[model samples]
Target: MTDFPQKARAAEAAMRAVFDATPLMRNDHLSGLHGADIWLKREDLTPVRSYKIRGAFNAMRKVLDADPSQDVFVCASAGNHAQGVAWNCRHFGTRGVIFMPVTTPQQKIDKTRMFGGDHVEVRLVGDYFDQTLAAAQDHCAEVGAHFLSPFDDEDVIEGQASVAVEMLAQMDGAPDVVILPVGGGGLSAGVLSYFRDVSPETEFWFVEPEGGASLTAALAAGAPVTLPKVDTFVDGASVARIGARTFARLSGVPRERVLLAPEDRICVTILSVLNVEGIVLEPAGALAVDVLEALRPQIAGKRVVCVTSGGNFDFERLPEVKERAQRFAGLKKYFLLRLPQRPGALRDFLDMLGPDDDIARFEYLKKSARNFGTVLIGIETKDAAAFPALFAKMDAAGFAYRDITSDETVAEFVL
Candidate 1:
């Protein structure tokens, strides 16, 4: 059996030829807030803006070293992994065929092309990831090309372990706790395995987006299980199933240590870091920081490290991000209101609003009858507490309204 630590260190050394180690910087803002010395392993600073490049590079390196004539590589991904593989493929002068879902954003596709140049060819396949993956695998077998998994293979896992290999070298001392964002379990499994051998005393927290928590589900079932459905808002770390090879390494991790980050709450963290810290982070990249408030009690007075996984955010989603953040902070709300058609009806309802309330959106849906109409209203308040007072005033004034801010079905169509 191979010693993972030794192989990971070797991989780390090999990666220097392609790109330097990403920064491990202390975050004073997070530290002050948590009353802990918080450091961020900035994997977002990599050449491909993700730790994924390390695995892709290492995996390809091993294959090429074993067989000099092999030059073809294949992978299926819509985001960071595609960029990583594309960038690494160009670095090694290898031919790559990347399969991406048809619905993948053009921003990601263009970036992948920019990274690979002439070294790679991208194929748009199925609309869903599963169909795309199947098409890629089938093509790989047909063409006799090496299939590089996002997280499942041994070499890929070993490549990801290089993250810990770099972190241990960069940190002054052993961190009291390490928080990682989990998707298909490649990075977490590799880091955990490396730390298990080297820094055995370090506590670990694995965070996953609430809507796609394969690791948490796997821990409960004692094996990897496919989720019936997954919300792909956090596209980078929203895997329906944890990779079997990666899960084999992660299976023993305690279920309690796996934290679930709500999609809306992640948007709040994304906005905070971007506005306050001037850091642009994707939903998965912000997962570790999003969980800090929840773990504040345990993290105080301890040295902690949060791995900011990737920074491949599409600026086009900025409006949606702001909307979700505001909603989560309770500063924005949508409601369906029944308003009487009398001349003073709107004036009376407007008077019910607090001083800080602002009507951001207002649209009359339909006249339910000659007396009243249905109105879709979006309100923005200076403080979350303002809603309670505003609601109380509305109640006293005999106004009829239903808060639809949390109604997914209505939000999907109206919000």
Candidate 2:
């Protein structure tokens, strides 16, 4: 047997002591739509509500076993990783110091504390994760604490490999295609390594949020490279660079096999799972599901596993998520329209709206023009098809407007 496969088997055996494998459920909605067996590896149901706990548990276990006196462990994470480390610390009766970005949401911090209990100490460091990471490493060195890499360590990789171990067993063998989410690459790297040895028949497809595709960049450069900027909207997986150790294992993956899911599309999937299935998933957690449309052709008639990585969502972000989902699904739009100063102008435009269209917002922007004034309006419609007809009517009536729904600046300032 391959060494990696052996490691995965060992890890899976140890994992049973903590929690049974997360369910691998065949989703009818997805299967019917895609014409394939679409199974979800529900990593979101882990003890810490994510797969991170596996890596955290395995890494700490190995370290403590090697040196029984190693009691202090330190890690940097803004979300799931922090909670994982905290939970593992409590499980092992060891003390852990977690560093998180100061901007982390209160809900995440509270959850981390709840998991760690008296075993973990939470430190809010820099505004950005990089700075917080640096502070954590420095603190770890100063205090002689074991620095636990969330995704870059060998033991952690072994722990993450447990996911594939459970997956293989749960599927009664191996899936034809395994769809994984790529963040820092630890989970994917470990799981892929295990599958490579035990289930060589399995094919891999990786998904990353479009604005934070560090793995795609690494594959393109043939080395890990930092993104100048990343959209943190998908907080759990919005990594700027792939972990070096994790990337070393992931480097062999074909560049085309790694795809980027649009950030907005991910939001839509989050809403779908939440509203339709009563499953609460964070934006990063839903990346794999959002790519089903792109994978439909290749996955048709095949058994595919989509890793729903984490569910540490904050209800406070619900409004923003719904807003993003609506915009992405073409159910909402914002436009700046020029309206004639004549009294009947607004009435004529209102008469043009379709039965399904609703005026969500209307505000006059400028009144300086002699014949017309600038008006900002937001419209929500039952169908995207309504926009074309509405635009045609506007054109025929000589209305001037600028669609600003997708304009980042406009969205931030006015929308």
- Candidate 1 residue 25 C-alpha distance from true site, Å: 0.3
Per-residue lDDT for 1-415 in model 2, tens only? 5688887778779878878889999999889988998999998999888999999888888898899999999999999989999998998999999999999889889999999999999999999888999999999879999999888899999999998888878767678999999999999999998887777889999999999999999999999999999999888888999999999999999999999998888988998888878887888889999999998889989999999999988888888888788899999999999998998999999999999999999999874657889999999999999998999999999999999999999878987
Q: Please name the candidate that would achieve the greatest TM-score relative to the true structure.
A: 1
Which portions of model 2 show Cα errors greater than 4 Å?
Answer: 367-370
Writing each residue's lDDT as its tens digit, candidate 1 over 1-415 gives: 2499999999999999999999999999999998999999999999989989988998999999999898999999998999999999999999999999999999999999999999999999998999999999999999999999999988989999998999989988889999999999999999999999999999999999999999999999999999999999999999999999999999989899999999999999999999989988899999999999999999999999999999999899999999899999999999998888889888998887888899999999874566879899999988999998888888888889999999999888986
Candidate 2 pairs with clashing backbones? none
In candidate 2, position 153 carries an lDDT of: 92
**Model 1 ranges with Cα > 4 A deviation:** 367-369
